[model samples]
Target chain A: MGIRQVANTEAPALTAAVDVRDLWMAYRPDEWVLKGVNLRVPKGQLWVVMGPSGAGKTTLMKVLAGLLPFQRGTVEVMGFRLRGDLTPPSRRVVGYIPQQLGLVRGLTALENVLLGSLARHGGLGPTLGFFPRSEVTRAREYLEMLGLGDKAETRVFQLSGGERQRVAIARTLMQDPKLILADEFVSDLDLPRAARILETIRGLVRERGLTLVMNLHEIQLVQELADHVVVLKDGKIVYHGPAGTLEWSSFRALVEAEDGRTGVAGW
Target chain B: MAEPGSLAGKGRDVNLRRWQGLSGALALLAALGWVLGRMGFFEPGRLTGGLVNFGRFAAELFPPDLSVLPVVLGALIETVEMAFAGTFLGFLLSFPLGVLGTRTLFPRPVVLAVRLVVAVTRTVPSLLWAVIMVIVVGLGPLAGTLALAVYTVGYLAKLYAEILEGVDPEVIEAVRGLGARRHHLVRYVLWPESANTVLSQLLFMLEYNIRSSTVLGLVGAGGIGFYMQVYISTLAYSRLATVLLAVLVVVVVMDVLSAWARRHYLLDT
Candidate 1:
């Protein structure tokens, strides 16, 4: 209750860009996967949602991104309700770097990045595949910042997993989204590459004031990078507070205790 | 547990015995046919009469005629044009129909209906279509082209749906993640991932359509086959040989070009 008051009071001063309450989704009926889950994200803040497999962290991220629907909850992004059939407009503000780093292998890095602008611009810009110079420059700038500028013409299939993930991040960033959701995006990366992704998200959250919510398997990353940590188990919130406020041992114990509990199934 | 296991083992033995009986019956049918052939009961009686007429026919067709080459070439060009025009039309039309037929995207009933319709379309061969088309349009290259086009649509749409089914959904998910609308998803993501695969299939279909185009001419449609029919009817065997040679050359060229296209564009990273 004290934590809720603190978060609520902080919400207005800090950016309360995302508000999710009592969310539930079951791909199969009578088998509830996400049972009454809730979380709040202030704008310009970095929040990490951490849990083991089947913990519903990814599902929560999907719901936040407006990619998946929830039957029993209300989701408001940037003060807009993501409900009913209002998905297309709501999804416009939510940028996502999915865990699988969904890169199209047939296209080169530049073409893949250029595809981001297509969603907003539609076909009005260019009939041929050539995009506008400014849009191309922006894509180049993002790739350059990610150290992939030289590899712009390289096919996506030739890239390493970490490189592909960076490109995915660049694609999402191209949207200049109000809120960013990255779902276990760094799981396959080596430690250094993983750190790079985290740092990039950190800078995005702090400098650009973008609301960032990331699903993670790594508990330590919460302490190192997150302003707030929302720990989940069996599709329910186990803890939600400032990262510094939670006791590390107590959180670990709750996670360990969950292993003995009956598992939740739907993804 | 023991009785169940023994019962299962007995069931397996019975199944094997039944399969053995089927194979034995098939072998007996083959042996009976061979024995009949050995007894001269299945001799080439049809071939003997056909050959006697063919010998008399061949003697009159000779002194090779060069004057007919011009007419044959014109018909041959028309046939080639029909093949190209039909293949292009079919390839273009199949894209949207194939999307409708994809089970992943469509409801069960829609996919089933589309599948049933496409299946029925493929059953009517190009030659049969040429005959039906001739009834509508009167015998000409237009009938041949339209018939081949119909055949191409049947084949391309069916194969296109299968190729679409095999496309990796990961790419689609990525595009979906970007919040792309339906058209963009299909145009950018789906087409690119499956383009090479579709291109390879398209080349093979072109080659097949070319071969079928010749037969389309047999029903008074237009092509090398019309020439083959004409010279044969008029006892111009040498002219028939010339027409056959022209077709063989054109077919070989189309084959090489298709193969080259498949190599150049389809087999790449």
Candidate 2:
């Protein structure tokens, strides 16, 4: 595989929305999930992280989202340097969509979206279900933007898988975050729906000047949506470059060689 | 030597275990029989005498004295009020205690400390608690209500802890990631997710407290049981019968009402 490094000399470290240096994470002693990882995402760019199952894809996203505390690393997201502790940085800057979507199934779609804005409104009002009217309106606007305005009052468990995915996206957007870490966000959707959602997400990222690091198994979507791509294998990056110049055939072989089976077959 | 796959070695071990289990069961049976003999459970003379006394008592219980109906009804109302007030007070305290006792929410030391308090409180029956409260606070409905509330806190807090612990961890993690504090989690995620179960348990506790509070008055804690004590001491079996009948009807009614409320409002039909 030909690995071409994308050099953005014009965009310095100051422009990096996400920067990770020599990150190492382990759930237990000496059993590392992420090892010596380094990543830098420039402002207003969509980056896709692709790897085979259990290749530390989700782990990397968890560390970036400040959900998982790494043993050793420097993770700086939206100018907040993460301490090696359980205390996550400010919720206003980073929004994370886990693989399960991390939604409260009992909550309404609108209420779930409103959760994103709770950090902004301190004290007991938000905790007691009294969100400010302006924030509530903003949540509705996010839902409307994601085409879930009609289903705002519906419970998350009642919504369809695609609709739920859209709700997750809308909720993340409701946080008004400068950085988004979405792990397998569209993996549940069909190709067409995934494409539509990705397009919408890309448009939003561009318009809002947000930086996104999304983990995906769909090579086609990765090819289409990624401004840059970082291919991880066994807790380390094997390839990092522009999405346009990524050799798809070689990339597939590199990830699928160990399983000896094709995933998301040829296109 | 028996071959690795051969049943000879395994069969011998299995036979030995079976014999050990048989001996254990036989020993347990022998112990139970000895305890029963020691307790005079096998004495036919004592058993017949007890039955004869019970028959006479049963005969006296008939033709219940209706003259005390108004007085019994007033005492019954006091019993019901005591149960309500006690259970409400317990419900108030249980939320915080439950949160502290929840293993998922609190640290090991906090959970252990809260659990220890709950276990100690639950170890004493509500009747015993009423006796203590009566001595401490003087005889009244206040003593009975306080006793019931303390016992309710112990029982309900343990249950609430279990419910809080059983909430979906993923949802909690998600909310925590959104920079939610511990209290925020209880209010938004844990409470909403487990509301139905928690409410149903509360109603069941109320029902149980009602039954318990009826007996608290025997110890001068103020309820229908106080009247029961008076009649029993005076050998007024008919009057005792009236109080017993009233208690039975109220208990049955409460059971039905609680069941209906749980079904109609708390549970998902």
Best by TM-score: 2
Residues A1-267, candidate 2, lDDT per residue (tens digit)? 111223434535457888799999899999998888888888889999988788899999888877778899787777667775556554578889888888887789999998887777768898778999998999899898889889999988789988988888888888888888899988888999989988988898889988889998787888888988888888877777777666668787777666433222222
The 10-residue segment of model 1 chain A with minimum total lDDT is A1-10
Question: What lDDT tens digits, residue by residue, belong to model 1 across residues A99-121?
Answer: 88777888889878877776677
Give the per-residue lDDT digits (tens) of candidate 2, residues B142-248. 99999999999989999999999999887888788887888888888888788888888899899999999999998999898899999999999999999999999
Score candidate 2 by DockQ.
0.47
Docking category for candidate 2?
acceptable
Quote the TM-score that chain A achieves in each candidate: 0.87, 0.89
RMSD each, Å: 6.1, 5.6
- Best model per DockQ: 2
Q: In candidate 1, which residue pairs clash? A: A15-A43
Q: How good is model 1 by TM-score?
A: 0.82
Clashes of 1: 1
